[model samples]
Target: MTNPERDPESGKLTERYSDEDFLEAVAELEPASTREIAEAVGCSRRNADVRLRKLEEAGEIRKKKVGNSLTWFSVE
Candidate 1:
């Protein structure tokens, strides 16, 4: 599934990320927060969180709560 959006300023199309993108981001930034993953994937925190949860369910990744924040880690 492709998430495509148009840039208001440039009036150009942009490609949103997928679950795989989030997974790669988590691997690259292991032990990162939702915000960090979202920023890296160019998506919203909520979006990243949802996909991250899905990946977690699939055993592709895991998360831990550090104080008030949830940090994600790659299983591989």
Candidate 2:
């Protein structure tokens, strides 16, 4: 695993599942909210959301709607 590519325009490093650091965080704290994931990864919720969405789209993760919030989990 390696670092996610930085956004060329924003100059911010975007979170991605392929990132070693992000993957380690997720392994320890999945079935978590975007906020939790962001905290664990030391990223913004917006950045975590972006990565989570990508994982969901890639079928690597799944989300369950709970009340008005969502919890993410790794696909098993």
| Top candidate (lDDT) | 1
**Colliding pairs, model 1:** none
Q: Rate the local accuracy (lDDT) of all candidates.
A: 0.87, 0.74
lDDT of each residue in 1-76, candidate 1, tens digit only: 3578999999988757777888888888988999999999887899888888988999989999999989999885
Clashing pairs in 2: none
The lDDT, on a scale of 0 to 1, for candidate 1 is: 0.87
| Candidate that scores best on TM-score | 1
Total residue pair clashes for candidate 1? 0
Ten contiguous residues minimizing lDDT sum, candidate 1: 14-23
**What does the lDDT read for residue 24 in candidate 1?**
85
Off by over 4 Å in 2: 1-18
| Ten-residue region with minimum lDDT total, candidate 2 | 15-24
Which portions of model 1 miss their true places by more than 4 Å? 1-15
The deviation in Å at residue 32 for candidate 2 is: 0.4
lDDT per residue, candidate 2, 1-76, as tens digits?
A: 3457889999988645454555566667876888888888877888778887877788877888888777888777
